[model samples]
Target: MDDKKVKILLGKRIKQLRQSFNFTQFVLGEKIDINQRQVAQIESGHSFPSLSTLVKLAKVYNCEIKDLFNYNHLEKEEKVKENIINIISNLDKKDAQLLYAIVKVIREK
Candidate 1:
């Protein structure tokens, strides 16, 4: 993926997971020892986090670091196939290709 796409993907995933646990930017920042603004930037895809910050976030959120990024592409695809075939069928070729690649990597693990 391109740099912009990667950033957006990571940011969206972080935001999704953070909200899933009912965490505010301030609360998550406090747990990770960063300011809320930094958390905002992370979730907004305006900045990239250092490895240490990523680790801290993973720890604070009680998730493995792998959960912070786009590792769920495969799982999402499966869910779509099982539960949302129309949505999956609507995806363009590029998206399907990307999903296929992610599924391949996930299966390898």
Candidate 2:
């Protein structure tokens, strides 16, 4: 995969993992000594974390660093949709409702 795709997949994975742990970007950043903005950027796939940062994040999430870069599952568009569904399924009803509305609006455009 291209570098941009790698960044996006990694970002999505990190975001899903972070949400599963109930860690806000700021809280996770604090735990890892990164700024919240950096976390946000990382989650948006706008910035690729350095190797040391990846190690810290992997340790925080209790996974191997290599697991963070597993791109096979992320290669499919359906996998991306599935990941989004998984994330939304974990959210509160109100947020999910809002997201549904937003998705409807976007799809209608």
Displacement of the residue 61 alpha carbon in candidate 2, Å: 0.7
Give all candidates' CA lDDT scores: 0.81, 0.90
The list of candidate 1 runs beyond 4 A from truth reads 71-109
Per-residue C-alpha lDDT of model 2 across residues 1-109, encoded as one tens digit per residue: 7888889889988988899999999999998889999999998999999898999999999999998877566567657788998998899999999999999999999
For every candidate, C-alpha RMSD to the true structure in Å: 10.8, 9.7
Q: Cα deviation in Å at residue 104, candidate 2?
A: 9.3
Q: Each model's TM-score?
A: 0.62, 0.68
Rate residue 68 of model 2 by lDDT.
86
lDDT tens digits by residue: candidate 1, 1-109 = 6776667668778888788889999998888888999989988878888899899978877888887875468446546768766766889999989988998999999
